[model samples]
Target: MNKPNQETLDELKAIYVQKIKAEFPKQLKNFSDKNAKEHQLSQLRGYLHKLVGSGESFGYTDITHTARAAESIATSLMSESTKDKPSRLTYLVKLLEKLAGIVDKIEIESPVTLHSGANFTDRQSNAKLLTVGQAHIAKTERKHTICVWVIDDDESVAAQLSEQLLSFGFDVAYFLSCAAFKQALLSSQPHFVIADVRLEDNSDFYRCADLHRIDLKSFGLIIMSAFDDFHARIKAVRSGAITYLQKPINVARVASFIHEHKNKIQLHPERILIIDDDTDLSALYKSQLEAAGMAVHNLSDPRKVMAAIQEYQPDLVLIDLYMPDFSGMELAAVIRQFDNFTSLPIVYISSETDNQRQSKAIATGGADEFITKPVSADILITALRTRVKRARQLNALISKDSLTGLLKHSAIKEAVKSEIARTSRDRQSLCISMLDIDRFKRVNDTYGHAVGDTVIESLANLLTQRVRQTDHVGRYGGEEFMLVMPGCDAESAQVILDDIRERFSNIEFTVGNKGFHCTVSAGFVQLEASVFLPTADSLVEHADSALYEAKNTGRNRVVQSITARI
Candidate 1:
């Protein structure tokens, strides 16, 4: 997921602080006037609930604890508040003052963010949450095109469907008879099959008996029939067709069906961050995470929290509950001061074995998990897996673009920077590809932004299908995209990107009855660790210059950057 930059995070954090400050006094006055009324007291509890949840996340730990306490007091006094106005008023006023002070503290301590921590289960679920798995994390990868073979008896209908499917970026082949399709199946397996119920020889292609004879489980099957009744649907279902469409298949529906299946084929590995002052413990966690096929980073000094965040950008942060200079809760609070890091999952790892005390710390720290020290490696892995998985799933919603699932600008930049440094240190190969849709404005001007978006989406999907899972792809902004290829050389990267460029250009995009194709230009820089490449920014700049070279040479090509200083 694309992580927001420091400046953007700071701006968002400031905005949130101001909003809370502005709402505090208005709500405080409303509560004060109706202190003795049960309904009004209930309303006051709502405000307290907000403070309890968000206050600590933004580093206002005191407000969170105080609001929690005040909520309990308010709840207890709800029934007797009429006879206890003086006491209710006194307690409520104190809470309001405390809330106001927290706002002041937030504004002054904006830059004093510490480190975000982890997620913890509720106190009752701590034992269950810690039950780990011995199984190591497995590495995931990516694949190729959505090759669909179409079988239908109608010639015009078959041609029309093929044209539309191709326009939507699918590789489609139309065959009039089942015999021909069966022959083609022997040569190459199609990812999908769109077959008609009837054939020229009057054979039932979707008959249950026929389905069992053919290896129907090998591919996604969609059957089309003029008869759109329950009987046809049930027979199609029994015949092993996953999708049953009527005579005239909606081209858009078929495209969406194919696109969703393509997405299901993509996978990304998990990344975890460990924040423990204990070098030994941090190393242990690192070893476990790595064994499970996860990328891990460790930080001993809490002072470099923000720098670590900018560089690491982990899915989950493992925080030690106890630290001498800075407490675990303090670090978690500091990380939360930045709005962007607020949602970051933090799990507390410490030697504190007392269940009540650990639970209290977990609750107060706003952590996602609380694991006792001397815990098994399996338990740690299980806890991190469950919590981090959820965090990443949620992160994608905010970090990825609506059109392409690629990381947005800031996040992708962060990813590229980290990978460049990693590959440089390990003496590995790294390539940065900056690609742009050639004459994108012309597409929008001629067709429309909506169609232009389809072109961009097509290119994004093609790139994902073409690259390895270890690589990163992001919509760097506008028509351009940035691809970070680790363990990939300039020549190999060029070959892969050129393949995507050719495929993207060949995809016949449709606008109503008319169809047009779009092309892409890419410039990538290979930073061979042994060859002494420049800074990350320099690499990107060089790639950009090379991209211009490609555009000048006539778009729809890939160019490798010169090793010499530009």
Candidate 2:
């Protein structure tokens, strides 16, 4: 099955869920009627069966299972005489209510598809809503929200800290001792940690060392020392504290730090690939694209187009229409042969102004948009941005893992191919990592699909947070993720995979009241141009083989491809 991107999956899921919810209650109510029960059970069964068939495609396995169970119960109730089995009818109604609750709780993670109405055009209305909502969220979330940990032994200092932080819309957590602060750090994961240099029994020595071990470099840490001596200040700096405050604490400086770093801390920039045979043209396009603040790759050789694309797995592509030996039309045609590249945007740019020539360019393959040269800088930039944005939207429609916000299996394959192609042409190293959630099926079977989805979402978030900005990470079907790392060799990629494996192994998940931990097994293949010339299928297969080795050897570790070593 082709996997849709997050936006596409969310839209589809929302529509499917809304449709089921709207229709099911009416169907259930009709079923309870004296004459309606005779005919309604068949309709209910049919609807539930349809949902079961389609739900997994949208990453709504929980909804699928519920529908399946409801279908079974409805079937059983229908078999019994209604007059003799009133309890059976009640059970069916209760099941329908439960299904309704599940549907209600399902969040609509993407924009809804607009429907036309007689009054206002639905598309226009939805566009307006999206614009407003986006602006609002961007404004709201961009504001600095400081989170501080107060590790003061005094009860009054701890209590006052919370009130002071709260006045400025900051979140504050108090810890009475070093041990209490350490325990709070494990669960709360606050943005900043503040501690007194002098703790009870001089335990600050070990406590400061422990905090440093947790990689608090990115976070703000201030040591409050009552002693004004230079020795105490030096001790605080050596212990890995950012700043040492002498007795008096400045709330203003702390606020300033939060404000300065708030926007600085963000997810990595998205990687983009540009394929054009003209070196001058590629550079020109790359400059404009880079100015827009996107990571861009430019390739001038059509022969290595696929290799470059696979290595970068770019979010979008801008291909020149005419090349020396192979035209952009021919290259796009070749790309279309691969299933992963079917929906990828391959925009053609050329000086060919004839209408017939433009039509011919598009006719060669799946050309999304065309640009006639000499391309205007602003016009070209707008066109590329629009194509990239649309690609993301289309991917959301068809290639998103609804719960995880990652690329669906088919999308991930396409992205990997594009990345590999880019890396190969650029002679940059590239890596592909296949990650499998260990004992995932067991989790699903034991705690139901709802809990399983939470686990998947959490893992996806962690992978996204850990990977480099240039890396491509996506959901490679059920309980598995695929990562494409450009400019990374086998050793560096292994280090990254191992770090992710360790972090994921320690993450604890709780569903209702039951807490459980899960681990991931990874197989990664890092390829240099000298070593395995980049092809999408070859790279993916190599990585998959390594992943198989990791799983066979034992879960929760990373294995590199032996083929690459050879």
Largest lDDT belongs to which candidate?
1
Q: What shift in Å separates residue 79 of candidate 2 from its native position after superposition?
A: 83
Write down the lDDT of every candidate, Cα atoms only: 0.71, 0.67
User: Which digits, one per residue and each the tens of the lDDT, describe model 1 over residues 1-566?
Assistant: 22223443353345456667777777777765443577777877766655554454445578777887777677677766377667767876787787678676765436433222322113212432232221111111232346777888888989888876665445678998877876676566677888888878777885532654568867888888888789889977876778798765655456656666653332344677777765434644554565565668878898887778866778888887766478788888888888768898888876555699887877777787887655655777788888977787787887898778889988888777778777756778888989999999999999888877777877776666567767889998889999999888877897888777776776766566677778899998887776554666788898899999999998988888886222
lDDT of 2 at 215: 56
Q: Candidate 1 regions off by >4 Å?
A: 1-266, 269-355, 361-366, 370-386, 530-533, 564-566
TM-score list, all predictions: 0.52, 0.41
* lDDT (10s digit) by residue, model 2, range 446-473: 9899878767765676675567656778
Model 2 misplaced stretches (Cα beyond 4 Å): 1-285, 295-344, 348-361, 364-366, 372-378, 395-402, 405-447, 469-494, 512-516, 521-566
Backbone Cα, N, C clashes tallied per candidate: 17, 33
Report model 1's TM-score to 2 decimal places: 0.52
